[model samples]
Target: MASKNRKPPRVGDQPGFRRALIAAVLVVTAIFIVAPLVVIGVQAFSQGWAVYATAIADPDTLHAILLTVTTALIAVPINTAFGVAAAWAITKFDFWGRRFLLVVIEIPFSISPIVAGVAYLFVYGLQGLFGPALQSADIKILFALPGIVLASMFVTAPFVARELIPLMQAQGRDLEEAATSLGASGWRTFFSVTLPNIRWALLYGVVLCNARVMGEFGAVSVVSGNIRGQTNTLPLHIELLYHDYQTAGAFAAASILAVLAVVTLVAKVLLERRGAGRGGRPTLAANQTVPETTT
Candidate 1:
């Protein structure tokens, strides 16, 4: 007898349609995001290497670049520490007003950086709340380096905490508990177990925080006083160049920032891929089958 014939599955069968749709959406999104970066890079190199050399060689531009790096180096670590502590406090403990504290920590992320600068000014500027006290001590915040660092710290504070909370929650407390049960002290458990688990997420947040600190303009502009070679950061320098009608210089400076951003993104991608690979590895099952009794 002949077997009954069955129709072959169509190429468009199953959830392939949804997968294709998602792929198309991702492609379009990638183009939308990358177009401006491509344009900036083209503009940066279009004027030849001489323009880049001139732009970077300028003393003011060089100073701004250095200041940007310095501010990020100082701010990122401080924020990372704050983020980790905040995340641990809010997630690992029960307390009154915990939700409120979390909301307050996130407020800076929602508020405009310019507004954050203004808020700082209200307290530290010449006419601000502490103006008299600061003046008496001969301390200057507005139009000074302190103001720039504070503003960057304010804006970047939430990055690491936001990345850490979900990670800690998903990871649960079993490993930590196990470590504690083994006679490990609190600090030992945290340093040896907790820190290792969350390090990648913290690093990811730091990379993002650094990128934002390097590129922040609105807040820096408010406090930097736009002092050439004094408080000027790379972003401020780019603005100054644009205002001075050195379009090529502006693009060149912008290109350097673009390169930094690209490097950060590449690092993030590689780290994420490594994390995923580690997570994908299978663990052995607790139960094992015995050999068959009857042969």
Candidate 2:
């Protein structure tokens, strides 16, 4: 009776309460996430392998795949570079308007992707600010590959920088300062000292950035003009297929993105286990040893 009346050591230590919480979470996950994924898989091959194969091989779908890949290839690396540079600048130095620069870098996160796409249209479209100049110069920026890439870049610009800043800020500048004092060049210090420590975090950021670039829809849709086989990306193409009542085709195309998302999730989990992710830091090398001393 006394034992029953006594409280558990922790707020959530009761077995019944724990079971209830776990059950609730599992139910939510199954309904919201696992169910949709299973549906996609089931529908993707619903018409059998031949139909799936045909949908996958369709020229429009293939073009969308290529365009998506092209956008990712171009955008990811540039954003990775920008992220690293911004993180380095913000964490490793003090300057005028430093806070302002940090805020500007994060503006992409606060603004809607659709809004950004519209702004790009105004800036580069035929009726836009530099529209006539670009037209006269035979330069095409809107409703083309360039516009798609630009919109994707804008939407995903903050991913790498957001991932790197916290980890870099936590790491501080002692290592770089010491390297500099020891006559190491800036490039050498960055490659040798800074790069090694931050590689995992950088890779984590790149993975997320690549995932976002491939999956991006809102901004890409607006700027791409949905030119079917021409400018349509995978996300846009999927919408087109679905709207045309090509459920199998849409699911097949969606399955590719789902697969990519799974791969990215796996990579993210692996990196997080390696001590890189949200609020995560890299672990030391296994080979490092402490010096022995005599008393």
Candidate 3:
């Protein structure tokens, strides 16, 4: 009779089950993620510091690094501005086709990078849409820095806006409206009221954007023409080295990208913590109403 009265065990309450799940997750992560990263590091330095340094200091590798950095420098900021404006327009105002604009902003996320690259080629290649005009004007777009930058920008365009849109939507426009009512200019309201509240998300988005720009391969590859020491970015450079059987050099170059990934992850974690600590809202100072301007 007492046995009949015993209740069923709750889900996830069994210690054995929990332990098994944890063990499975750890095993998978170690094999797939951790093991590969460890192998890259080990192989990169396997040939001694001199070899690794030589690989990194190679002229082609240096140019690749510079090209990657330059692409990121150009793409990230423009995308950031575009994202901020897009989010602001989508969330802070009611207008016709607002939903359409939102969908357009998200198009890049849905489209394949390689496909975007192909599309750019059709539009900018030697025999492409504006090709003749460009040729006549002596403007080179394909197989150059500009092509690489455009590809990177296209692939990373949505990052900042995607991060900001939901957060800003949740925040609504009350503070911005209040500030505007108190004689604050549009820029003033944005800088004072909106920026502080969304800074963490903005920063998180920028980090992710920058990381993607640096590591992008498919789209850039299609557009850049893989000119050694000219248009090849780091990822392409890594591939070139591996193809040439310079395995250590490839791994060394890949290590730089891995380091960037780690830094981005760290920044993401820090920003999440900071946002959580503040409830993802502006501080009290930012909440204060703007003083009205007197004549």
TM-scores for all predictions? 0.83, 0.91, 0.90
Q: Is candidate 1 or candidate 2 better by lDDT?
A: 2
Best by TM-score: 2
Clashing pairs in 3: none
Q: Candidates ranked by TM-score, best first? A: 2, 3, 1
TM-score of 1: 0.83
Sequence-dependent TM-score of model 2: 0.91
User: Global lDDT for candidate 2?
Assistant: 0.87
Top model number, lDDT: 2
Clash number for candidate 3: 0
Give the local distance difference test score of model 1: 0.81
For each candidate, how many residue pairs have backbone atoms clashing (under 3 Å)? 0, 0, 0
Give a tens-digit lDDT track for model 3, residues 1-295: 5884496667885789989999999999999999998999999999999999999999999999999998899999999999899889877877776666666666777678899999999889977899788989999999998999998988887788777876887788899999999999999999999999999889988998999999999999999999999989999999999999999999999999999998988888898887622332322121111112122
Winner of 2 and 3 under TM-score = 2
For 102-210, candidate 1 gives per-residue lDDT tens digits of 6677677778888988888888987799988998999887788888999999987777777776677567678988999999999998899999988888788888889
TM-score of 3: 0.90
Residue 86 in model 3: lDDT = 86
Candidate 2 residue spans exceeding 4 A from truth: 1-9, 280-295
